[model samples]
Target: MLGGRAVTLTVSSLADVSALLAALPEGEAAAAAAAAAREPRLTKPAGSLGRLEELSAWLATWQGAHPPRFERPVARVFAGNHGVAALGVSAFPPEVTVQMVANFQHGGAAINQLCRTFGIALDVVALDLDHPTADFTQGPALDEAGFLAAFQAGLDSVPDGADLLVLGEMGIGNTTPAAAIACALFGGEAADWTGRGTGVVGGALARKIEVVAAGVARHRGLPPLEILRALGGRELVALAGATVAARLRRVPVLLDGYVVTAAVAPLEAARPGALDHCQVGHVSAEPGHRRLVGALGKAPLLDFGLRLGEGSGAALAAGLVKAAVACHTGMATFDEAGVSDKG
Candidate 1:
């Protein structure tokens, strides 16, 4: 079983991965209809809960069950170092990735606290802290074998019977690669996708934009999957793989902030409905994140000027999703509550 789903999927190459994405399994129609039918009979005015109602239905649609519940939610944070960090694109050094991963492992990070608060099982996957990918401006970040390895690692990260998956990433210089991937997937200039990741500003931000532009220019017009190998890191590709694994397993996904969004953006571009089972957990403070989400036509569940990676935003949003599912599953129907139907 692949992530608790009975499917035989072999992803040895990007072509295989692309083909898999192009012909992905769809969500359950009956479960979606069942959730919709149950929504209006819950003794409340129609459309009162706004996005919460949609969240419940989304959970049902993706989970393929009548009463959707986020019982076994898992949060994954993929951490990797980047060769492009040598370009001075970030305010912090690349070694920070290792430091942050240790923090997460030791339960001292914000994501750790948030995961505990929201009752999410946390998994921190370090792609390769000692070895960073090749600098994109010089050449591809990862070769075919390397990319596939990282992708498979991501695929293997998803747990069995997880009703919900929350994805995030940690890499000091990852925003540069994420911006480059966004620029390649969507038609945009470097400045349009690049932002002040790691609090770089002034000339530092300008340097980051230049680096993203150079990477895109060197590897532009490649296929969507190639764009990932050309400009993305191991953690980024792993996030994409985990997203695919979750969808294939029929588990709903809550995507974290900017880097995570950019990591999985190529899936949607390669196939339109690739991300139908996923939602933006929260919008990050990175300016490019807002534009990227807009390009994906996604409405984030929350916006609190959050820019911390490592699945923090998604973990916070998990509580809200749990509440949404609770209301959908536990609320009494009009007849059960002795409430009059809308007449």
Candidate 2:
């Protein structure tokens, strides 16, 4: 059903994710050539549009179309409860995750407004809110079965006919897991990645750092995906899965914030270029996000000091994508307008 593929593979194992990685389609060079050819004729000085021009070509290359159409962008926010929240790592309680999901459903969240403003459909997947992951300070957050289930849930969250996917998460205290993931994947001290999630102050932020340090120390030296299973929450893993699913479907993805970036970081670490079709929608106000994006070599599309997750930043980036696509497709050529071309 997805991408008109005859075989639908379920991500029940990390090996399956590996297989998907091996099978990831390369970008369309011809479409990129087409985009490049059109960009010069679009009545603008060469390279004047900056990222908008690059964004247009990126849309063409990833969407595999001559003139890319940004019609069906979808944002999916995965919400889950983290057992690590019990450590006083975040200002908000885990129960807030469930409540926030209801807010998304009721069109009451900032993401809801962002989605309406950007014309992107928003879907929320609350993964096992009643069953929070085991506290990673003591042990693995999710065992193999639980990990696979959340990963599969992520893969399934991606819908068919989606032109692009914007991934965000709504798990309270999840920045702890996200920090842990970044620490494990990037070989950083926990304090470097841990930040004030939910506005935790001095003591709470320090405790969050300690918790991240412990989680990474306990689950270090594993494969990237295993690190993710050990340190990341359900919503994080699901975002990773949806990213894989989007790439498999040849759909581009806009990633949101530190948590979402950390969620998908393992994939790129596991297999280089796994996230080539993906871009960070914005640099989060979270301290670690700027460093994380720098590590991934992705210059974010927007940066307004936004730390609100739930795909709000990504939905806002969708508007940029639409503008990029619109300019690429709708702008008049120098020849068509009878304007002077660069001589």
Candidate 3:
């Protein structure tokens, strides 16, 4: 029901989901157990270090080995325009979307710097979800038909054998529509999720809240497809489609923030198991982002109170995943190290 072209598999009951979850590799758990069993002898008392030790063990389990590797990780930033910018809900003008896209292409944005620092491969895709006029220039600037084409293009662009994928956004007024989409999917008032985006102050914040509420009100009884059409951006829709494609290809997706999460909701609705492929990178400063994460039943890895929305949070967290993999792969088990399991 969420992704227009997605095929809904017949899942009759909760048992089906249980079966699916059961079939997933228990490697992470096994790795965790192994890591935990080895920690007491590493010149530390049992459980003295608390969460960091627990996290290391957890990563070992998730990687399904005593040590994990996050080598050759990739971050993909998806860019598009939201039609709601016309509603004047943001401080920056809509042209900033295109300008920022150019900035990203030129390797000048925060994500670029962070990814370069971490040695992560970065990929950018433009989704044609809205028609930007001469007044507004950054694009996968597409009408409905063009959006569909761009969606397919995004699906095709994913590289094979990618260990991780981080989805990010670059639309100027996208938070307005992102909040609207969140409200529609999760049954909340738009104002509850709306927040000041991009340093909007005073009257601009109030206007943003009002615009989101209006969009939610307008799409109240509409179907998901119609709601997306009415309030969604090209980037959101393309990300949703790309999420589905990524799942089919068996790659993990790291959601950057509220906007990227909202864009990928249709994928969750379309393929319920698809959510398993995603990891939320962080809790965003955007008010709606927490609500969205709650709706998806996901806990973010970090919270730096970020509101930048340029894959900054996701790029930042990539280092953690790498460390996780390193600990999982490099640390020896008690049996291998000939240490007693007991503290």
Candidate 4:
């Protein structure tokens, strides 16, 4: 019923997702306070560590410990094909989605290398590799049953014993659907919500923008779930399910880039404050990603113009999170170091 097999679910609607979705566990405020209290007593000037200190405290609060442990950090890359890829939204063809899934399986993708470098476990979820979704510009991307199925498949992919979960996606032309969903949910012009995905420009970029505009215009005024049904691909649906599952299980999620961020957008709108359990891995080169990150009200941990999905950004940021956890737990306090506290 949870993570693993895509079993049949009683959940048939977004309301079901919300009803079954538990809010993130109330982080240990006492632990966070304890961490902050200890920081001042460490053998260093106050606030010298800057964001690292804050990150440490956040981990403490999330884990209910003054010094949290970073055990079993994992990343999952959800790969699928979008029917909108027929529109040339991305420079890469839809076949590239299948090819890249192979790359991920062979440990040749950026995310695979990054995850290996950081000693994180990696799983590539290919739910729609051979089964692409319907083109949204023409009709609903997935039927209600299909959407729920994809959602469950994604929900089941979150690994057990994971201290932190990183979510990413690979779907050619997904940016078109992501942009359409963002425009519908966030109320922005299609051009504003769209971007130069995979470096498509000039005429290709113009057509991509037009596709998004038409898709959003057709699906306007729909509810969050309807918007997803109209515009979301299998990978995006799965990403959203994974995000909801993470929040329900009290696992902190590191979202990769634009597609992942857009996938979580509807949840934030539906659950209100659900994103408190999530963080951005990076500010991607994709323009909509900035708007998506802003809408979530969370700052990215890094900004290296990364637009390559497949959990690449999340893998890079996971290392930083692990380091923050180590610093929180391993550093010597003034008392432990026999150093005098500030008088």
lDDT of 1 by residue, 126-215 (tens): 997899999999999999998999999888898879999999999999989989998888877899988898899999999999999999
Cand. 4 TM to true fold: 0.93
Misplaced by over 4 Å in model 1 are 1-6
Give the per-residue lDDT of model 2 (tens digit) for 271-329.
99999999889999998999899999999999898998988888899989999999889
| Model 4, span 5-79: residue lDDT tens | 343334677667666554335566788898888888777888887877877777666655566668888888888
Candidate 3: Cα lDDT at 115: 90
Tell me the whole-model lDDT of each prediction, alpha carbons only: 0.91, 0.89, 0.66, 0.82
lDDT of 2 at 340: 96
Name every residue pair that clashes in candidate 4. none
Per-model TM-score on C-alpha atoms: 0.97, 0.97, 0.78, 0.93
Summing lDDT over every window of 10 consecutive residues in candidate 3, give the lowest-scoring window: 133-142
Ranked candidates (lDDT, high to low): 1, 2, 4, 3
Q: After superposition, which runs of candidate 3 have C-alpha atoms over 4 Å from their true positions?
A: 1-68, 128-130, 133-144
* Clash totals for all candidate models: 0, 0, 13, 0
